[model samples]
Each structure stands twice: as C-alpha cells, then as structure tokens.
Target: MALYDVLLALDPSPVVALNRAAAVAMRDGPEAGLALLEELAGARRLRDYHPYLLARADLLHRLGRLPEAAEAYRAALAAAGSEPERTHLRRRLAALAEAGHEV
Candidate 1:
C-alpha cells in the first residue's frame, strides 16, 4: 500500500489510482474504496474505462449499495469490449434485479 502511495504521488496514473483504491478498500473498508473509485469516476480519462465501472460495481455490491452497484454494472456492460464481460455483468445485474431490486 505504501508503495502504491508513493507511485501514485509520482505518477497519479489512473491504473495506479484504481489499484490504490483497491488497497484502501481492503485496508480501510469497502466504503473507503468506493469513495476513491467515485473520485476516479469523475476523471474524463476513465469515462469509457469499463474496469473502473466494474470495480465500483464490485465494491458497491460488497457494501450492499445495490442500486448504485446495478447502475455501475450496467455502465460496465455498455463499455465492455468483449461479449464475455458483458455476459458476466448481465448475470450480476439480473441477479440484483431478481433480488427484488429494480435493477
């Protein structure tokens, strides 16, 4: 985590930021991770990055923030470059919807 912190300070690369966010989430909490992901979501460079959306969806799902998770999953589905990722995200979204949520 400290290594990622130093790397981010020097580079601030989005991938590094995402990795750090995952580290923070693991060390702090899903909420902390989701917060950093939310901040990263505002960056234009990540607008079409399905990985960001997928990360957010995963964290949100872990935190029981189902509505937001479903939305993020949908965004990831839309941006996914491959059919497999889209199919997986669709399954997750469908599971959420079946759980009595309007996903």
Candidate 2:
C-alpha cells in the first residue's frame, strides 16, 4: 500500500490508482474504495477496462447496492477479455438476479 502511494505520487496512472482503490477497499471498506473509484470516473484509461469495472462491481455488491453492482457487472462483462471472465461476471449477475435485481 505504501508502494502504491509512492507510485501514484510519481506517476498518477489510472491503473495504479485503481489498484490502490482495491487495496483501500480491502483495508477499509467498500464505501471508501467506491469513493476512490468515483474520483477516477473520468479516467479515460478505465472507461473500458474490465478490471476497473470488476472492482467497482465487487465493492457495490459487497455494499448491497445490487442494481448498481449489476450495471457495473454488465459493463465489466462487455469489456471482459476472456471467456472465463465473462462466465464469472455472468455468475455474479445471476446472483444479483437471485437477490431480486436484474442485470
């Protein structure tokens, strides 16, 4: 995490920021991470990045924001680079459906 802070200070790269957001989510909570992601909403590099979308979806899901999570999962699914990633996202969407939110 310290390394991330240093790297971000030096580079301010969107990918590194996203990674730091994930780490913050792990150490703090979904809301904190979601806040960081919100700060990066305008980052062009993350617009179609599946991993960024995945992190946001996971955090929203953890926070019980099912509809938002489903939307993010849909976006992630669309951006996914592999069949396995698509399958995983599909399962997450199915779970949201089971929870009464359609993706």
For each candidate in turn, the TM-score is 0.92, 0.96
Which residue segments of model 1 deviate by more than 4 Å? none
List candidate 2 segments past 4 Å from native. none
Candidate 1 whole-model C-alpha lDDT, 0 to 1: 0.91
| lDDT for each residue of candidate 1 in 1-103, tens digit (9 for 90 to 100) | 8999899999998988998999999999999999998888778878889888888999999999899889889999999999999999999999998998878
List model 2 lDDT by residue over 1-103, tens digit each. Answer: 8988999999889999999999999999999999999999999999999999999999999998888999999999999999999999999999888877877
> Candidate 2, residue 39: CA error in Å?
0.4
Instruction: Say which candidate scores most in TM-score.
Output: 2
In the order shown, the candidates' Cα RMSDs to the true structure are 1.1, 0.8
lDDT of 2: 0.94
Per-candidate Cα lDDT values, in order, are 0.91, 0.94
